[model samples]
Target: MKSKNTMFLVQAATIGAIYVVLTLLFAPLSYGEVQVRFSEALTILPYFTPAAIPGLFVGCILSNLLGGAIPVDIIFGSIATLIGAVFTYKLRGSSKWLAPLPPIVANTVIVPFVLYYGYGVNLPIPLMMLTVGAGEVISCGIFGMIVLTALSKVKGSVFGKASYSK
Candidate 1:
């Protein structure tokens, strides 16, 4: 039991660190209107382990801090990721194809407002949604699907049997 808990913590921390590092690597592209955060690809991890929820949330918070986000973006943006991770965890057992939808949807819905109000972008809401959603689709959907496929092969080694709660 103790070892299992330790493993869970280690996995979560490692995921968080990876997320922060990836976000930092793409800082310039990640902060702007057309954000293609490579880190968003990790959002699919919740499909394999509940630990991914806190992992992704903390990672988003840390990434936002490092990215020098505004206060509203820091608060609300993290909230969006938290919500998305929770949704992903809930849908963990359904299908791998559905895993990345939570983050993509969450970011799509929330980020448009953040761009318009927080960043003071003058674009229309529909345009913001399209752009942000497209970014998420590419990052969380396309790249994330590729990652999910690769991770699925290693799920047993990384997350263990009970990790797939479905």
Candidate 2:
């Protein structure tokens, strides 16, 4: 029992750490109107374990903070990630192709507001939505699917069968 809890914590922490690293490493492309956050590729991770929900939420918060985002952007942007992660985890039993849709939709719907009001980005909301959606499609939709595919091939070896039932 103790070991299970410990493993859950470890997995969550590892995911959060990796998210921060990826976001910062691709800092230029991780934030802004025309951005493609590489860390978003890991958004598919919630499909493996529910631990990813909080991991991704905290990771987005930390990433936005370290990236010098305004308070509004930090708060709302993180919320978007939280919502997406939750939905992705909830859909774990569904088709693997659906894993990326949650984040893509969540970010596309929420990020435009963050960019326009929070960051004072001059683009129209529709334009921002288009750009942000495009980026999400690339990161969450495309790269996320790729990661999902690779992880599915080795789920037991890496994340463990225990994760699925959790």
Candidate 3:
């Protein structure tokens, strides 16, 4: 039982670290209105492990902070990630294809307003929404799905059957 708890902590920490590193590595494309955050792909991990919820939330918060985002963007963006991760975990019993939807939708709907009110960007809200949505689709929808597929193949080795909840 102690070893099981240790695995959960290690997994969550590793996921969060990967997310932060990915965002920083792609700093140029990880922020702004028109952006594709590669870290968004990890949002799908919740489909396998509940640890992904807090992992993603903490990662987004750290990424936003290091990326020099405003307070509103940091707070709301982290909240958006939290919401998405929760929904993804909840939808785990459904089709694997559906796991990424929450992050894509949450960011698409929330980020435009952040760009407008939070950062005071002059771009029209609708346009920002479109751009952010497209980025999310690429990151969360396309890339996330690919990540999920790849992870599925190696899940038993990487995560062990006991790592995930039934």
Which candidate has the top score in lDDT? Answer: 3
Residue-pair clashes, model 1: 0
Better of 2 and 3 by lDDT: 3
Model 1 C-alpha lDDT per residue in residues 56-84, reported as the tens digit of each score: 88999999998889989988888888888
For each candidate, the alpha-carbon lDDT, in order, equals 0.87, 0.89, 0.91
Model 3 residue 112 CA deviation (Å) reads 0.9
Model 2 spans > 4 angstroms off: 162-166
| Candidate 3: 10-residue stretch with minimal lDDT | 157-166
> Across residues 1-166, which tens digit of lDDT does each residue of candidate 3 receive?
9998898888889899999999999999999999999999999999988878888999999999999999999999999889999999989888888889999999999989999999899999999989999999999999999999898878878766723323
Q: Quote each prediction's TM-score.
A: 0.94, 0.96, 0.95
Instruction: Give model 3's TM-score versus the native structure.
Output: 0.95
Ranking by lDDT: 3, 2, 1
lDDT of 3: 0.91
**TM-score-based ranking:** 2, 3, 1
Worst 10 residues of 1 by lDDT: 157-166
Please give, for residues 36-118, the per-residue lDDT of candidate 2 as tens digits. Answer: 99999999999998778888988999999999999998999999999899999988888888888999999999999989988
